[model samples]
Target: MNELLSSAIKALGEKFGGQVSEFRDEVTLLIPPDKVTAAATVLRDEFTFDMLSAETAVDYCPQTNPRFHMVYIFYSTTLKVYLTFRAHVNGDDPKIATMETVYPSANWREREIWDLFGIRFEGHSDMRRLLMPPNWEGHPLRKDYPLGYEEVQYSFNFDEIDVRKPKGVR
Candidate 1:
Protein backbone atom coordinates (compact mmCIF):
# COMPACT_ATOMS: atom_id res chain seq x y z
CA MET A 1 0.00 0.00 0.00
CA ASN A 2 1.13 3.54 -0.73
CA GLU A 3 1.65 6.04 2.05
CA LEU A 4 -1.59 7.89 1.23
CA LEU A 5 -3.80 4.79 1.11
CA SER A 6 -2.14 3.32 4.18
CA SER A 7 -2.92 6.48 6.12
CA ALA A 8 -6.50 6.59 4.88
CA ILE A 9 -7.10 2.99 5.88
CA LYS A 10 -5.52 3.66 9.23
CA ALA A 11 -7.80 6.61 9.76
CA LEU A 12 -10.92 4.70 8.83
CA GLY A 13 -9.90 1.78 11.01
CA GLU A 14 -9.22 4.06 13.92
CA LYS A 15 -12.40 6.05 13.53
CA PHE A 16 -14.92 3.39 12.65
CA GLY A 17 -13.32 0.21 14.00
CA GLY A 18 -13.13 -1.12 10.47
CA GLN A 19 -11.19 -4.25 9.67
CA VAL A 20 -8.93 -4.45 6.62
CA SER A 21 -8.35 -7.29 4.20
CA GLU A 22 -5.92 -6.85 1.33
CA PHE A 23 -5.20 -8.71 -1.88
CA ARG A 24 -2.61 -7.67 -4.43
CA ASP A 25 -3.11 -3.92 -4.97
CA GLU A 26 -6.56 -3.66 -3.46
CA VAL A 27 -7.76 -3.22 0.10
CA THR A 28 -11.26 -3.83 1.45
CA LEU A 29 -12.36 -2.27 4.72
CA LEU A 30 -15.17 -4.06 6.47
CA ILE A 31 -17.20 -1.60 8.49
CA PRO A 32 -20.03 -2.17 10.88
CA PRO A 33 -23.43 -1.94 9.29
CA ASP A 34 -24.57 0.93 11.51
CA LYS A 35 -21.42 2.98 10.86
CA VAL A 36 -21.23 2.45 7.11
CA THR A 37 -23.00 5.68 6.17
CA ALA A 38 -20.90 7.84 8.46
CA ALA A 39 -17.71 6.15 7.28
CA ALA A 40 -18.69 6.64 3.63
CA THR A 41 -19.23 10.33 4.25
CA VAL A 42 -15.73 10.60 5.69
CA LEU A 43 -14.20 8.74 2.75
CA ARG A 44 -15.79 11.19 0.31
CA ASP A 45 -15.26 14.41 2.26
CA GLU A 46 -12.01 13.71 4.08
CA PHE A 47 -10.17 11.13 2.00
CA THR A 48 -11.20 12.37 -1.47
CA PHE A 49 -12.60 9.03 -2.63
CA ASP A 50 -14.90 11.14 -4.74
CA MET A 51 -16.59 8.66 -7.03
CA LEU A 52 -18.63 5.70 -5.89
CA SER A 53 -17.72 3.57 -8.88
CA ALA A 54 -19.63 0.44 -7.94
CA GLU A 55 -21.96 -0.71 -5.23
CA THR A 56 -22.96 -4.36 -5.04
CA ALA A 57 -23.51 -7.29 -2.70
CA VAL A 58 -22.81 -11.00 -2.23
CA ASP A 59 -25.11 -13.48 -0.57
CA TYR A 60 -23.81 -16.32 1.68
CA CYS A 61 -27.02 -18.04 2.50
CA PRO A 62 -27.49 -21.21 4.65
CA GLN A 63 -25.01 -19.46 6.94
CA THR A 64 -27.16 -16.63 8.17
CA ASN A 65 -24.77 -15.01 10.64
CA PRO A 66 -24.02 -12.48 7.94
CA ARG A 67 -26.26 -13.11 5.00
CA PHE A 68 -24.74 -10.42 2.82
CA HIS A 69 -21.57 -8.47 2.27
CA MET A 70 -22.25 -5.06 0.77
CA VAL A 71 -19.36 -3.89 -1.37
CA TYR A 72 -18.64 -0.26 -2.25
CA ILE A 73 -15.88 0.73 -4.63
CA PHE A 74 -14.59 4.29 -4.63
CA TYR A 75 -12.18 6.01 -6.98
CA SER A 76 -10.13 9.10 -6.28
CA THR A 77 -10.01 11.25 -9.38
CA THR A 78 -7.36 13.53 -7.90
CA LEU A 79 -5.03 10.85 -6.56
CA LYS A 80 -5.75 8.19 -9.18
CA VAL A 81 -6.35 5.47 -6.63
CA TYR A 82 -9.14 3.12 -5.66
CA LEU A 83 -10.45 2.04 -2.28
CA THR A 84 -13.10 -0.55 -1.49
CA PHE A 85 -15.41 -0.65 1.49
CA ARG A 86 -17.52 -3.53 2.76
CA ALA A 87 -20.08 -4.09 5.48
CA HIS A 88 -21.64 -7.19 6.97
CA VAL A 89 -25.44 -7.20 7.02
CA ASN A 90 -27.26 -9.70 9.21
CA GLY A 91 -29.48 -12.29 7.60
CA ASP A 92 -32.55 -11.28 9.55
CA ASP A 93 -32.11 -7.60 8.67
CA PRO A 94 -30.05 -7.27 5.54
CA LYS A 95 -29.83 -3.51 5.44
CA ILE A 96 -27.36 -0.68 5.63
CA ALA A 97 -27.86 3.04 5.30
CA THR A 98 -27.95 4.30 1.72
CA MET A 99 -24.83 5.87 0.25
CA GLU A 100 -26.77 8.14 -2.14
CA THR A 101 -26.45 11.05 0.26
CA VAL A 102 -22.68 10.87 -0.17
CA TYR A 103 -22.64 9.54 -3.73
CA PRO A 104 -25.60 10.31 -5.93
CA SER A 105 -24.77 7.56 -8.42
CA ALA A 106 -25.45 5.04 -5.69
CA ASN A 107 -29.12 5.66 -6.39
CA TRP A 108 -29.35 3.15 -9.22
CA ARG A 109 -26.57 0.85 -8.08
CA GLU A 110 -28.25 0.38 -4.73
CA ARG A 111 -31.53 -0.35 -6.43
CA GLU A 112 -29.86 -3.05 -8.50
CA ILE A 113 -28.38 -4.59 -5.38
CA TRP A 114 -31.72 -4.55 -3.65
CA ASP A 115 -33.42 -5.99 -6.66
CA LEU A 116 -31.07 -8.90 -7.25
CA PHE A 117 -29.50 -9.59 -3.86
CA GLY A 118 -32.55 -8.86 -1.70
CA ILE A 119 -30.54 -6.59 0.56
CA ARG A 120 -32.33 -3.35 1.41
CA PHE A 121 -30.65 0.03 1.53
CA GLU A 122 -32.10 2.16 4.27
CA GLY A 123 -32.97 5.74 3.34
CA HIS A 124 -32.69 5.14 -0.40
CA SER A 125 -34.65 7.64 -2.50
CA ASP A 126 -36.18 5.16 -4.97
CA MET A 127 -35.96 1.77 -3.34
CA ARG A 128 -37.44 -0.41 -6.07
CA ARG A 129 -36.42 -3.03 -8.61
CA LEU A 130 -33.93 -1.70 -11.14
CA LEU A 131 -33.70 -4.65 -13.54
CA MET A 132 -36.65 -6.83 -12.54
CA PRO A 133 -40.39 -6.26 -12.78
CA PRO A 134 -42.16 -4.74 -9.76
CA ASN A 135 -44.22 -7.92 -9.38
CA TRP A 136 -41.16 -10.17 -9.41
CA GLU A 137 -41.52 -12.64 -6.56
CA GLY A 138 -38.03 -12.59 -5.04
CA HIS A 139 -34.44 -11.62 -5.68
CA PRO A 140 -33.38 -13.97 -8.44
CA LEU A 141 -29.65 -13.65 -7.92
CA ARG A 142 -29.69 -14.98 -4.39
CA LYS A 143 -27.92 -18.24 -3.66
CA ASP A 144 -31.06 -19.80 -2.24
CA TYR A 145 -33.26 -18.73 -5.11
CA PRO A 146 -34.97 -21.66 -6.80
CA LEU A 147 -33.76 -22.02 -10.37
CA GLY A 148 -35.83 -23.69 -13.09
CA TYR A 149 -34.33 -25.02 -16.30
CA GLU A 150 -35.33 -27.07 -19.34
CA GLU A 151 -33.30 -30.11 -20.28
CA VAL A 152 -31.74 -30.45 -23.71
CA GLN A 153 -32.16 -33.61 -25.75
CA TYR A 154 -29.97 -35.18 -28.39
CA SER A 155 -30.89 -37.19 -31.53
CA PHE A 156 -30.50 -40.46 -29.60
CA ASN A 157 -33.27 -39.35 -27.22
CA PHE A 158 -35.44 -37.53 -29.75
CA ASP A 159 -38.24 -40.09 -29.49
CA GLU A 160 -38.30 -39.87 -25.69
CA ILE A 161 -38.02 -36.05 -25.77
CA ASP A 162 -40.87 -35.71 -28.30
CA VAL A 163 -43.17 -37.65 -25.97
CA ARG A 164 -43.07 -34.87 -23.32
CA LYS A 165 -42.42 -31.73 -25.37
CA PRO A 166 -45.47 -29.50 -25.59
CA LYS A 167 -46.80 -29.09 -29.12
CA GLY A 168 -49.02 -25.97 -29.14
CA VAL A 169 -47.00 -23.45 -27.13
CA ARG A 170 -44.89 -22.16 -29.99
Candidate 2:
Protein backbone atom coordinates (compact mmCIF):
# COMPACT_ATOMS: atom_id res chain seq x y z
CA MET A 1 0.00 0.00 0.00
CA ASN A 2 2.78 2.39 0.96
CA GLU A 3 4.70 1.65 -2.21
CA LEU A 4 1.66 2.24 -4.41
CA LEU A 5 0.89 5.51 -2.58
CA SER A 6 4.46 6.70 -3.12
CA SER A 7 4.37 5.92 -6.81
CA ALA A 8 1.07 7.73 -7.22
CA ILE A 9 2.26 10.80 -5.35
CA LYS A 10 5.45 10.93 -7.40
CA ALA A 11 3.57 10.71 -10.63
CA LEU A 12 1.13 13.43 -9.51
CA GLY A 13 3.90 15.78 -8.43
CA GLU A 14 5.63 15.38 -11.78
CA LYS A 15 2.47 15.77 -13.81
CA PHE A 16 0.81 18.55 -11.78
CA GLY A 17 3.78 20.47 -10.34
CA GLY A 18 2.55 20.07 -6.73
CA GLN A 19 4.64 19.37 -3.68
CA VAL A 20 3.90 15.95 -2.27
CA SER A 21 4.50 16.84 1.33
CA GLU A 22 3.03 13.71 2.96
CA PHE A 23 2.27 10.21 1.78
CA ARG A 24 1.59 7.04 3.75
CA ASP A 25 -0.94 4.29 3.10
CA GLU A 26 -3.28 7.23 2.42
CA VAL A 27 -2.03 9.75 -0.12
CA THR A 28 -2.36 13.47 0.52
CA LEU A 29 -2.44 15.56 -2.61
CA LEU A 30 -1.92 19.27 -1.98
CA ILE A 31 -3.26 20.98 -5.08
CA PRO A 32 -3.52 24.54 -6.30
CA PRO A 33 -6.86 26.25 -6.85
CA ASP A 34 -7.00 25.96 -10.65
CA LYS A 35 -6.33 22.23 -10.65
CA VAL A 36 -8.49 21.13 -7.72
CA THR A 37 -11.42 19.62 -9.61
CA ALA A 38 -9.19 17.98 -12.17
CA ALA A 39 -6.98 16.54 -9.46
CA ALA A 40 -10.01 15.24 -7.56
CA THR A 41 -11.35 13.57 -10.68
CA VAL A 42 -8.04 11.88 -11.31
CA LEU A 43 -7.93 10.57 -7.78
CA ARG A 44 -11.51 9.40 -7.89
CA ASP A 45 -11.52 7.83 -11.34
CA GLU A 46 -8.00 6.80 -12.21
CA PHE A 47 -6.66 6.29 -8.72
CA THR A 48 -9.83 4.42 -7.74
CA PHE A 49 -10.64 6.70 -4.80
CA ASP A 50 -14.41 6.83 -5.16
CA MET A 51 -15.92 7.58 -1.77
CA LEU A 52 -16.21 11.16 -0.60
CA SER A 53 -15.60 10.90 3.11
CA ALA A 54 -15.59 14.62 3.88
CA GLU A 55 -15.50 18.09 2.40
CA THR A 56 -14.35 20.84 4.75
CA ALA A 57 -12.36 24.03 5.01
CA VAL A 58 -9.49 25.33 7.12
CA ASP A 59 -8.58 28.94 7.78
CA TYR A 60 -4.95 29.96 7.96
CA CYS A 61 -5.33 33.67 8.43
CA PRO A 62 -2.52 36.22 8.79
CA GLN A 63 -0.58 34.45 6.08
CA THR A 64 0.47 35.35 2.55
CA ASN A 65 -1.77 34.81 -0.49
CA PRO A 66 -4.33 32.02 -0.29
CA ARG A 67 -4.69 31.98 3.47
CA PHE A 68 -7.54 29.46 3.53
CA HIS A 69 -7.86 25.86 2.43
CA MET A 70 -10.63 23.39 1.56
CA VAL A 71 -9.97 19.72 2.08
CA TYR A 72 -11.56 16.63 0.51
CA ILE A 73 -11.13 13.13 1.89
CA PHE A 74 -11.94 10.17 -0.34
CA TYR A 75 -11.96 6.41 0.16
CA SER A 76 -11.96 3.72 -2.50
CA THR A 77 -13.92 0.54 -1.99
CA THR A 78 -12.40 -1.10 -5.05
CA LEU A 79 -8.82 -0.24 -4.10
CA LYS A 80 -9.49 -0.37 -0.37
CA VAL A 81 -7.50 2.83 0.14
CA TYR A 82 -7.85 6.44 1.26
CA LEU A 83 -6.81 9.67 -0.42
CA THR A 84 -6.93 13.31 0.66
CA PHE A 85 -6.78 16.48 -1.43
CA ARG A 86 -6.57 20.14 -0.49
CA ALA A 87 -7.19 23.34 -2.43
CA HIS A 88 -6.11 26.76 -1.27
CA VAL A 89 -8.14 29.92 -1.82
CA ASN A 90 -7.84 33.56 -0.95
CA GLY A 91 -9.40 34.29 2.42
CA ASP A 92 -11.33 37.23 1.03
CA ASP A 93 -12.73 35.23 -1.89
CA PRO A 94 -13.04 31.68 -0.69
CA LYS A 95 -14.78 29.78 -3.43
CA ILE A 96 -14.25 26.52 -5.28
CA ALA A 97 -15.99 24.11 -7.61
CA THR A 98 -18.33 21.62 -5.98
CA MET A 99 -17.67 17.90 -6.11
CA GLU A 100 -21.34 17.01 -5.79
CA THR A 101 -21.39 16.23 -9.51
CA VAL A 102 -18.82 13.52 -8.92
CA TYR A 103 -20.07 12.49 -5.49
CA PRO A 104 -23.64 13.34 -4.64
CA SER A 105 -23.06 13.04 -0.87
CA ALA A 106 -20.89 16.17 -1.05
CA ASN A 107 -23.95 18.39 -1.26
CA TRP A 108 -24.54 18.71 2.49
CA ARG A 109 -20.87 18.73 3.40
CA GLU A 110 -20.16 21.52 0.92
CA ARG A 111 -23.08 23.52 2.24
CA GLU A 112 -21.70 23.08 5.76
CA ILE A 113 -18.29 24.32 4.76
CA TRP A 114 -19.94 27.38 3.25
CA ASP A 115 -22.08 28.01 6.33
CA LEU A 116 -19.12 27.69 8.72
CA PHE A 117 -16.16 29.03 6.77
CA GLY A 118 -17.99 31.00 4.09
CA ILE A 119 -16.28 28.91 1.44
CA ARG A 120 -18.53 29.08 -1.58
CA PHE A 121 -19.05 25.75 -3.29
CA GLU A 122 -19.78 26.67 -6.89
CA GLY A 123 -22.26 24.47 -8.80
CA HIS A 124 -23.78 23.10 -5.58
CA SER A 125 -27.45 22.43 -6.37
CA ASP A 126 -28.68 23.87 -3.07
CA MET A 127 -26.38 25.91 -0.86
CA ARG A 128 -27.83 26.95 2.48
CA ARG A 129 -27.08 27.04 6.18
CA LEU A 130 -26.80 23.53 7.57
CA LEU A 131 -26.04 24.03 11.28
CA MET A 132 -26.47 27.74 12.00
CA PRO A 133 -29.96 29.20 12.26
CA PRO A 134 -31.24 30.85 9.09
CA ASN A 135 -31.02 34.32 10.64
CA TRP A 136 -27.47 33.97 11.94
CA GLU A 137 -25.16 36.73 10.73
CA GLY A 138 -21.56 35.86 10.12
CA HIS A 139 -19.60 32.70 9.58
CA PRO A 140 -18.84 31.90 13.23
CA LEU A 141 -15.90 29.65 12.46
CA ARG A 142 -13.85 32.33 10.75
CA LYS A 143 -10.87 33.41 12.81
CA ASP A 144 -11.80 37.07 12.65
CA TYR A 145 -15.41 36.44 13.74
CA PRO A 146 -16.29 37.37 17.29
CA LEU A 147 -17.76 34.81 19.70
CA GLY A 148 -21.05 36.79 20.02
CA TYR A 149 -22.32 36.15 23.52
CA GLU A 150 -24.11 37.97 26.30
CA GLU A 151 -23.96 37.58 30.08
CA VAL A 152 -27.05 36.54 32.10
CA GLN A 153 -27.98 36.81 35.75
CA TYR A 154 -30.21 34.51 37.81
CA SER A 155 -31.29 34.15 41.43
CA PHE A 156 -31.62 30.64 42.88
CA ASN A 157 -33.39 31.74 46.12
CA PHE A 158 -34.98 35.16 46.03
CA ASP A 159 -36.45 34.67 49.53
CA GLU A 160 -33.05 34.17 51.11
CA ILE A 161 -31.11 37.11 52.54
CA ASP A 162 -29.51 39.17 49.82
CA VAL A 163 -25.76 38.80 49.61
CA ARG A 164 -23.51 41.76 48.98
CA LYS A 165 -19.94 41.91 47.74
CA PRO A 166 -17.27 42.55 50.38
CA LYS A 167 -16.68 46.28 51.03
CA GLY A 168 -13.52 46.70 48.94
CA VAL A 169 -14.24 43.88 46.49
CA ARG A 170 -17.04 45.66 44.64
Candidate 3:
Protein backbone atom coordinates (compact mmCIF):
# COMPACT_ATOMS: atom_id res chain seq x y z
CA MET A 1 0.00 0.00 0.00
CA ASN A 2 1.09 3.57 -0.62
CA GLU A 3 1.95 5.94 2.22
CA LEU A 4 -1.23 7.98 2.03
CA LEU A 5 -3.55 4.96 1.87
CA SER A 6 -1.63 3.23 4.62
CA SER A 7 -1.94 6.29 6.84
CA ALA A 8 -5.62 6.58 6.11
CA ILE A 9 -6.19 2.91 6.83
CA LYS A 10 -4.25 3.30 10.08
CA ALA A 11 -6.44 6.20 11.10
CA LEU A 12 -9.57 4.25 10.25
CA GLY A 13 -8.32 1.25 12.21
CA GLU A 14 -7.53 3.48 15.18
CA LYS A 15 -10.93 5.14 15.18
CA PHE A 16 -13.02 2.12 14.23
CA GLY A 17 -11.92 -1.48 14.48
CA GLY A 18 -11.65 -3.30 11.13
CA GLN A 19 -9.71 -6.05 9.40
CA VAL A 20 -7.78 -5.31 6.19
CA SER A 21 -7.01 -7.68 3.38
CA GLU A 22 -5.39 -7.21 -0.01
CA PHE A 23 -5.56 -9.24 -3.20
CA ARG A 24 -4.56 -8.52 -6.78
CA ASP A 25 -3.72 -4.90 -5.89
CA GLU A 26 -7.11 -4.32 -4.28
CA VAL A 27 -7.39 -3.35 -0.65
CA THR A 28 -10.56 -4.26 1.21
CA LEU A 29 -11.48 -3.35 4.75
CA LEU A 30 -14.09 -5.35 6.59
CA ILE A 31 -15.51 -2.65 8.81
CA PRO A 32 -18.40 -2.67 11.24
CA PRO A 33 -21.87 -1.88 9.96
CA ASP A 34 -22.47 1.08 12.28
CA LYS A 35 -19.21 2.91 11.54
CA VAL A 36 -19.76 2.98 7.78
CA THR A 37 -21.14 6.51 7.58
CA ALA A 38 -18.45 8.06 9.72
CA ALA A 39 -15.66 6.14 8.04
CA ALA A 40 -16.92 7.11 4.58
CA THR A 41 -17.00 10.76 5.57
CA VAL A 42 -13.41 10.60 6.77
CA LEU A 43 -12.27 8.84 3.60
CA ARG A 44 -14.06 11.31 1.40
CA ASP A 45 -12.79 14.40 3.19
CA GLU A 46 -9.28 13.37 4.19
CA PHE A 47 -8.24 10.50 1.95
CA THR A 48 -9.70 11.89 -1.29
CA PHE A 49 -11.94 8.92 -1.98
CA ASP A 50 -14.53 11.25 -3.41
CA MET A 51 -16.53 8.85 -5.51
CA LEU A 52 -18.60 5.91 -4.33
CA SER A 53 -17.96 3.99 -7.51
CA ALA A 54 -20.19 1.05 -6.69
CA GLU A 55 -22.16 -0.60 -3.92
CA THR A 56 -23.12 -4.27 -4.10
CA ALA A 57 -23.75 -7.33 -2.00
CA VAL A 58 -22.65 -10.98 -1.86
CA ASP A 59 -24.67 -13.80 -0.35
CA TYR A 60 -23.03 -16.68 1.54
CA CYS A 61 -26.09 -18.76 2.11
CA PRO A 62 -26.44 -21.41 4.84
CA GLN A 63 -23.93 -19.44 6.91
CA THR A 64 -26.03 -17.32 9.18
CA ASN A 65 -23.15 -16.00 11.22
CA PRO A 66 -22.26 -13.76 8.28
CA ARG A 67 -24.70 -14.50 5.59
CA PHE A 68 -24.09 -11.43 3.47
CA HIS A 69 -21.36 -8.93 2.66
CA MET A 70 -22.02 -5.36 1.55
CA VAL A 71 -19.21 -4.37 -0.77
CA TYR A 72 -18.46 -0.65 -1.15
CA ILE A 73 -16.08 0.56 -3.85
CA PHE A 74 -14.47 3.96 -3.43
CA TYR A 75 -12.39 5.73 -6.05
CA SER A 76 -9.95 8.57 -5.62
CA THR A 77 -9.71 10.45 -8.91
CA THR A 78 -6.81 12.67 -7.94
CA LEU A 79 -4.82 9.84 -6.43
CA LYS A 80 -5.95 7.32 -9.04
CA VAL A 81 -6.58 4.73 -6.39
CA TYR A 82 -9.41 2.42 -5.48
CA LEU A 83 -10.37 1.14 -2.03
CA THR A 84 -12.99 -1.35 -1.01
CA PHE A 85 -15.05 -1.40 2.17
CA ARG A 86 -16.88 -4.58 3.16
CA ALA A 87 -19.33 -5.07 6.00
CA HIS A 88 -20.79 -8.38 7.12
CA VAL A 89 -24.46 -8.84 7.99
CA ASN A 90 -26.19 -11.90 9.35
CA GLY A 91 -28.85 -13.75 7.34
CA ASP A 92 -31.66 -13.00 9.76
CA ASP A 93 -32.84 -9.43 9.25
CA PRO A 94 -29.63 -8.20 7.63
CA LYS A 95 -29.38 -4.43 8.04
CA ILE A 96 -26.66 -1.81 7.78
CA ALA A 97 -26.27 1.93 8.13
CA THR A 98 -27.28 3.91 5.08
CA MET A 99 -24.51 5.21 2.83
CA GLU A 100 -26.97 7.37 0.94
CA THR A 101 -26.37 10.29 3.25
CA VAL A 102 -22.67 10.27 2.47
CA TYR A 103 -22.89 9.14 -1.14
CA PRO A 104 -26.07 10.28 -2.81
CA SER A 105 -25.40 7.86 -5.70
CA ALA A 106 -25.83 5.05 -3.21
CA ASN A 107 -29.59 5.50 -3.36
CA TRP A 108 -30.24 3.18 -6.29
CA ARG A 109 -27.29 0.95 -5.57
CA GLU A 110 -28.55 0.30 -2.05
CA ARG A 111 -32.02 -0.26 -3.37
CA GLU A 112 -30.71 -2.81 -5.86
CA ILE A 113 -28.86 -4.60 -3.09
CA TRP A 114 -31.99 -4.65 -0.95
CA ASP A 115 -34.09 -5.85 -3.82
CA LEU A 116 -31.77 -8.65 -4.82
CA PHE A 117 -30.05 -9.61 -1.53
CA GLY A 118 -32.73 -8.63 1.00
CA ILE A 119 -30.18 -6.58 2.95
CA ARG A 120 -31.90 -3.49 4.27
CA PHE A 121 -30.19 -0.18 4.68
CA GLU A 122 -31.28 1.51 7.89
CA GLY A 123 -32.09 5.23 7.56
CA HIS A 124 -32.36 5.06 3.77
CA SER A 125 -34.97 7.61 2.75
CA ASP A 126 -36.57 5.37 0.10
CA MET A 127 -36.36 1.65 0.68
CA ARG A 128 -38.09 -0.16 -2.16
CA ARG A 129 -37.53 -2.64 -4.95
CA LEU A 130 -35.27 -1.52 -7.76
CA LEU A 131 -35.68 -4.27 -10.34
CA MET A 132 -38.17 -6.73 -8.83
CA PRO A 133 -41.88 -6.04 -8.52
CA PRO A 134 -43.23 -4.60 -5.27
CA ASN A 135 -45.14 -7.84 -4.56
CA TRP A 136 -42.17 -10.16 -5.14
CA GLU A 137 -42.01 -12.64 -2.28
CA GLY A 138 -38.37 -13.76 -1.85
CA HIS A 139 -35.14 -12.18 -3.03
CA PRO A 140 -34.38 -13.97 -6.29
CA LEU A 141 -30.60 -13.67 -5.96
CA ARG A 142 -30.49 -15.60 -2.71
CA LYS A 143 -29.11 -19.11 -3.02
CA ASP A 144 -31.92 -20.57 -0.93
CA TYR A 145 -34.60 -18.76 -2.92
CA PRO A 146 -36.73 -21.24 -4.84
CA LEU A 147 -36.04 -21.82 -8.51
CA GLY A 148 -39.36 -21.85 -10.34
CA TYR A 149 -38.07 -22.48 -13.82
CA GLU A 150 -39.88 -25.09 -15.96
CA GLU A 151 -38.03 -27.82 -17.73
CA VAL A 152 -37.59 -27.59 -21.50
CA GLN A 153 -39.05 -30.35 -23.67
CA TYR A 154 -37.07 -31.75 -26.62
CA SER A 155 -38.17 -33.58 -29.78
CA PHE A 156 -37.50 -36.95 -28.12
CA ASN A 157 -39.98 -36.09 -25.35
CA PHE A 158 -42.58 -34.54 -27.67
CA ASP A 159 -45.14 -37.25 -26.90
CA GLU A 160 -44.80 -36.77 -23.16
CA ILE A 161 -44.78 -32.97 -23.50
CA ASP A 162 -47.94 -33.07 -25.63
CA VAL A 163 -49.65 -35.20 -23.02
CA ARG A 164 -48.96 -32.53 -20.38
CA LYS A 165 -49.57 -29.55 -22.67
CA PRO A 166 -52.60 -27.36 -22.18
CA LYS A 167 -55.70 -28.55 -24.03
CA GLY A 168 -56.18 -25.28 -25.98
CA VAL A 169 -52.52 -24.34 -26.36
CA ARG A 170 -51.11 -23.55 -29.82
When superposed on Cα atoms, how far off is each prediction in RMSD? 1.9, 6.8, 2.2
Task: Show model 1 residue runs off by greater than 4 Å.
Answer: 159-170
Q: Using TM-score, rank the candidates from best to worst.
A: 3, 1, 2
Residue 21, candidate 3: how far off, in angstroms?
0.6
| Candidate 1 structure, TM-score to reference | 0.91
| lDDT tens digits by residue: candidate 2, 1-170 | 55655666676777776666555545577887777777767767677777898878888878736878878888878766677778788876778888888889999998888888888888889999999998888898888887765333357643242343222554
> How does model 1 fare in lDDT?
0.88
Error of 1 at 136 (Å): 1.1
C-alpha TM-scores of all predictions: 0.91, 0.79, 0.91
Weakest lDDT window of 10 consecutive positions for candidate 2: 158-167
lDDT of 3 by residue, 1-170 (tens): 68889998888888888788889989899899889889999999999999999999999998997999889999999888899999889888899999999999999999998898899899999999999999988898888987876557899998888787666656
Whole-model lDDT values for every prediction = 0.88, 0.76, 0.90
Number of the candidate with higher lDDT, 1 or 2: 1
TM-score of 2: 0.79
lDDT of 1 by residue, 81-148 (tens): 88989888889878889999989999999999889988888889999899999999888888989775
